[model samples]
Target: MPLPDLLVSAIALVRDRRVLMVTARGRDVHYMPGGKIDPGETAAQAAAREAFEEIALDLDPDDLVELFEVVTQAHGEPDGRLVRMRVFRAETDASPSASAEVGALHWVTTADLDRCPPAGAEVLRRLAASGTID
Candidate 1:
């Protein structure tokens, strides 16, 4: 049987027509800053916590606006495994740097979608279609 879908939360921090993306240590594909939701934590809270943990960004859960959700094949996992991502868009003035599991930080436009996982690429495409990013 296929494994259960991975549940995750992600944040979109866009500025100047670009959105923030991150690559985990030793990984080449990039995605939004986020991870699995801990037990008893809301998706928004998980997203905020992941942002801080992965990229050293301080995000308030209350400030996150639900942008959209994506269901796609889970990157780095078995072929049948899927990921359900709850994505949010929020404004942050603080600078983000690579930290924790994050290997690097990048500000990417739609042109860089191919560098992301399926779910991440879908998020970028939607953001671009909505004019949220270039």
Candidate 2:
């Protein structure tokens, strides 16, 4: 049988020296502020929706700058599953707070990557390499 398809859209809302991260309820690994792409929704649309749903921050789809697209083993999911991630950078001055499925929210830097999931760590590493974050 084919592997279960898992497609997600995430956002890195960077400001100052930190990027926004969220921990799902009952989960320890923090991830970028976004979630799965719903049927009929564009990846950018999903990214914006997930950001607002999880962090209570409304982000315009047009304001999101596409950053990276990576396919990797799914984290916290069944074996043999894969995740296709479309990561974006949203420009906003709004503060993020825990909401919806988010249990805790944090603004993290490169030093805090140990607490992040693998995909999230990859995102941060790329951002740092691109000089987008310190």
Candidate 3:
């Protein structure tokens, strides 16, 4: 069965090459600071909301970078479902700190991308190729 819901995520790039990432308090992997879009919210709205929740950064709805949607091949689901991710880019007022759902925070550059989660690696690739990300 396919996953019922899609994930909408946003990448807030800073200093050209570094982007914001969050690690949930108990989680081991670093991921972009966005999350699931609630039933009534648009993908862009959800991206901004999640960014604020996870990183304590205030993202104006207008500031996010509009990138292509990503249809990620099934990787983690035992049921073999693809993940539809809507990724965006934007510059932030400042680097966000871990808060609420987040337990750790880091600013990652292309050089350090290999250490990030697979999804993040994909994002970096798209960013570098399209010039929307650093």
Candidate 4:
């Protein structure tokens, strides 16, 4: 059986060769620092909002460059839910600290991508293959 699709926005904050990943409190799996778009919110707006909520990284919505969008099984959701993630890339030097539901923030290089969730794994793969992030 297939899950109903979910729409969400995700942001990739890349600096040097590392991208930022966050883990929710009490959770072990890592994910990109973004979340579901609110009603009437655009993808970029949601990405910016989620970034600030999760990591305290204040980003301009206009600064986000769309990297890609993918549909994948929602990692922690019920069995019948899928996520359509719109990923964006931005350059930021501000340090990211855990906030809101985020427990910790980790800088993930190409070698550390395996620590991420499925959607994050796909984002990393696409970024790596495109040479957007090493």
Q: Any idea what lDDT model 4 has? A: 0.85
Q: Alpha carbon lDDT of residue 67, candidate 3?
A: 78
Can you write out model 1's per-residue Cα lDDT over 42-120, one digit (the tens) per residue?
9999999999999898889999999999999998899989999999997988999899688899999989988999999
TM-score for each model: 0.95, 0.92, 0.82, 0.89
Off by over 4 Å in 1: none
Ranking by lDDT: 1, 2, 4, 3
Ranking by TM-score: 1, 2, 4, 3
Tell me, by TM-score, which candidate is best. Answer: 1
- How many residue pairs of model 1 clash at the backbone? 0
lDDT of 3 at 95: 58
Query: After superposition, which runs of candidate 4 have C-alpha atoms over 4 Å from their true positions?
Result: 1-3
What is candidate 4's TM-score against the reference? 0.89
Worst 10 residues of 2 by lDDT: 70-79
Q: Write the per-residue lDDT of candidate 2 for residues 1-134, one digit (tens) a residue.
A: 86877899999888887788888899888889888999999999999999888898899998898998867778877777888889998888777789968999887888988997778888888888888888
RMSD of each: 1.0, 1.4, 2.3, 1.8
Candidate with top lDDT is: 1
Error of 1 at 23 (Å): 1.0
lDDT of 4 by residue, 1-134 (tens): 76668888988887777778888899878889988899999999999999899889899999999988988888878875888999988668788889968988887766766777778888888888888677
